[model samples]
Target: MKNKEFIFLMILAAFLSATESYALDIEFSGSRHTVIKDKPEASTGLNDVFTIYDIKEVSFISIGNIIAPSDFRVLIYSNLGGGYAIEQPVSITGTTAFIHNPKGDMGYIVEDGDNRYCFWVVDYAGKHFDISSIEAYPEQDCDMTKITVIGSGDQIRYYSVSGRQCTLSRNIELSYNTLEWDNENNSYSLVEKTAGFEYLQTPLTLRPPFYCNTTVTVSGDRFLKTWGLGKTLESSIIEANGIDVNTEAVQTNLAPDDASNMIKSDGTMLGGSAPADFTFYAYVTDAVLHNEWQIADDPEFEYVRYRFNERDLTYTFDQEGKFYVRFIGSNADGSCEATGETYEIGIGASDLRIPNVFSPDGDGVNDTWKVGYRSLVEFKCWIFDRNGHQLFYFDRPELGWDGKHHGKTVSPGVYYYVIEAKGADGKKYKKGGDINILRYRKIGNSSGASGE
Candidate 1:
């Protein structure tokens, strides 16, 4: 019984050891170029594909650490057809394999039973390319700019033109394998790498124009490799001659009133009492052919009230209506225009008054004890019983408390209210007073005031 248990334990240990040593590795010789090993993407049945650049031919290839060497076969795939015949290695010695002067631009796969290992060979000799010059010029008809790149290469792998606010890039599709080896058919087959997606071939001379001063970069690739990994021969920084207009309008004066606790304006939007002076300044880019500050009654600028041709304007808004202000800037030819965001400026008379009593008798006339307010920015009100227990609180003047506590009607009595408020017109308020709650009872079709 002990011998039988020992034999079973030995067999289990050997099985785990063999499973751990099943990983295979391949090596290449007679290649002075660098090797790039790319792992397969997620859910792609493809294996790691090795890439070698600037090599005309590989002298020999070796597969090491291979288990069951007879079951492994090195197959070189043709790049022309999908169902073409596969080529075999010239010789195989132990775990090493060799091919006689293997051609470039071909994919090879090592079949180890059901597993497949893929690799690519690229002959990049005398295939170098460089950019001679990059020139930028404005169009004759409009303000659109155009860039032209002069280079000598098989294909442009990637190019980008970047500016202060915009960037345009064009890249080639080379990282993915659209055709994978099929074991059953002994040929290459088309496979969808991603669902509902197909690779797009980038054009060589698809250079788009830039709006501002930009930097231009370009690279070229002659063999199959990922974009941007190729050598970039030249990069140029260009200054645009055409105008790219950008404008901003901001309020400069942000002083609060001294007599009241008025919140300071952030210059984006201003409101408050009448006779307010608001100073607006413009921050613009590029050469301005014509610029103006306009004030309108509507947001769409259908009725423009005033127009100032200066870069800055300081106007006193004494009216009692909401106004909109914006700045517009244009280029010399008016082909390019830029407009700042419209700012809403409200100028209204400040008024806030609280009622002494309110009757929430479900009559909808004086149901809530809201205050009569106009342009009141900040407000807070608190209601308490005679014993100083807080019953209701509100921050906006538009909201009022009904004569109820804890979701039930309170007893008819006098309640105290405390208020702390600040108006948009820089007026501070701190007032408290008695609030009388009256309940009316209908008797014989006649309403009579009962609790007060």
Candidate 2:
């Protein structure tokens, strides 16, 4: 959502002057248990199909019945329609109902003919549903006037039911409508009012982890269920590393590393190790401290970081937007407050930190640049080339490093890798997973490689 907002593709917003939206006339009775059609005089019996449209709102009530009391349920649907993905299901309450992404999903429920009373109110546009395979569904012999369309779309199709030929299409939005399921004392309609809430989504700056395939929660949404860096730092900042960081991101210095974790709805918390070498902290204020604060020059994350209290005070978030990032440097000699560069993003605070770097000079320190899930429950790692070729694949963290092929060391010049580890729980399904990879420096043969 950085530059573009998510919009529902289904549109006819002002098809014929927004003011002249169509309306639906509704009537219901408790005794008959079916919607009463005084205006449209439609008859929806055991099996009948029709198309409905131009409907704005309807009001009525139905009586008790064996199935759905002539309310919303107890109805059949052949071809259903609504807005774009907005029609996604939030949750389900029926059995044997699984949702498939591209294959499409359909649902069906039967009324055991038991006396029951139930009614429900649903949002028309923002969301919709499909119901089929019912006793009356696809049965065209019932009645036709009982069903009609309330929207316009060639998308309306039909469903052939065993021993029945009734088919109906339901597609409408932005308005309220009502109908009955049966002809008993039950009648239905929409007449009450409800409340609505709105929110403004904020843009997130963190890129998908470069480690490998795994999930990371950004802002509040979880992304990159499995990831690993594949492209060189010079290629698209949005390589296999996940998410996207600008190519201009600093390499001389890295962004401060500060990642926090929250428990998912299932009580799964991703407690993984952060790059052990980098130090990052954040604080915020209103005024930009260009003079007092000396943040890192061309910080990788592009956020201002100043030194203070002898500690690395570079990535402090300016919550209040007040002011206060002073550069401070420390050496083997001593540490003191110093002015750092002054960098800025957005109004308050923002930036990502790349605490992990590979330059594994034979210094024998920070030696292994690899993904770790010591805390994540189930782990799966993948190594890929810049062209998306899968290389080394591991299922555990302890199995990292050694940087060898079948039996020899693999040449190194920034090979691409991704990880698909599972932490928290429900792994095989990809959850609290994160990605990271190994960076090795191939010098001498297995000998000098020491414990080579």
Candidate 3:
């Protein structure tokens, strides 16, 4: 182990890295290049392995801080795959012995041999666990106290461009519930005070003379101010700091546009088509989030999700049986990864859809008549007096009932219902209901009384 540690030191001295290692445990070969480990299903490479016997360095992926009793993810370049930056994230447990490489490219890991090895320790407190041995990156040397911009067409989406930071109160809480900090379901956000980044929207096209430079500024957080994009694209820019970020999402246009049109369908700006009104659909996608990249874009399990890339749908099953549901689309770069929505399914739902709520009260809330299908091409609902005499018809969900017949409130009694609808499936499903309206009211000259 001592010999292995010596080798790691030598390689780190050679790399002369510029990044700060935060939570990851790193190691290197004799050349100072990184060693890579990866887990594909996740965006942050949480499952990558860092070899200890080999020995090297640990460098923060960038400039940041790592806290003990919390889960940290690291990214390392691979010396094995010909200089490729592979992920070698280390989930620290014990007060593991690791340090930054000379170049800051990695965390010089303990070589496994005589007395050193990089491994974590675990413990079960009252209810949770604790993980420690964390390090923070160095602060940027540049002052950058000021912010400026030089262009338009400024657009920032996803977790990309925010200026909000966590504010700690005078009384700080130091209790570490390892499970709360290390659980995949647990996320900790620290909003720090930062400045010097902005997002500005210049005219879609350079108004007069066209220049290639464009800029966005993001300010207000210290942690983000130092995240240099490597190359400057435009002088006019927007910037922000102290905001939450999924740094692992380095790829471009990889997530679905939550508000854009459904992919390949009507209202879509990219793929799919805009079908004429009334189309039925049912689709399902995973709700699991591999990493923090698209954390804010995940679907609501009890609601629906709409996307802007590819909208392909087929009827799927739900607890309510097979129903028409729709998944607008998936992101061009993301594979329903940390991007989705919640849902329910039903038959003939693509047409004027009516929820299961029916008003049987003489008082109005859902009273009078119901045409629950709001977006229907053609819809009709009929109410009868049990003798089969048609008394009401409705076509819109918003159309309410006053519980009256010929300007007189109908008496509390049993009623019959029939519905006709033209749904997205083109095929019609005629359904009927035998309802009982049990609402009662005061009977007198302006009498005021009611019950259900």
The most accurate candidate by TM-score is 1
Our model 1 lands, by Cα RMSD against the true structure, at 19.8
User: lDDT tens string, model 3, 89-205?
Assistant: 344445442323423212222222222211111111121111121111122111111222232212221110011121111111111111011225333322222122223322111
Q: lDDT (CA) for every model shown?
A: 0.54, 0.26, 0.30
- For each of the candidates, the C-alpha root-mean-square deviation to the true structure, in angstroms, is 19.8, 30.3, 22.8
Better of 2 and 3 by TM-score: 3
User: Model 3: which ten-residue window has the lowest total lDDT?
Assistant: 170-179
Q: How much is 105 displaced in model 3, in angstroms? A: 26
Error of 1 at 427 (Å): 21
lDDT per residue for candidate 1 within 131-165, as digits (tens), equals 56555433422343444555544421111010011
Candidate 1 lands at a TM-score of 0.52
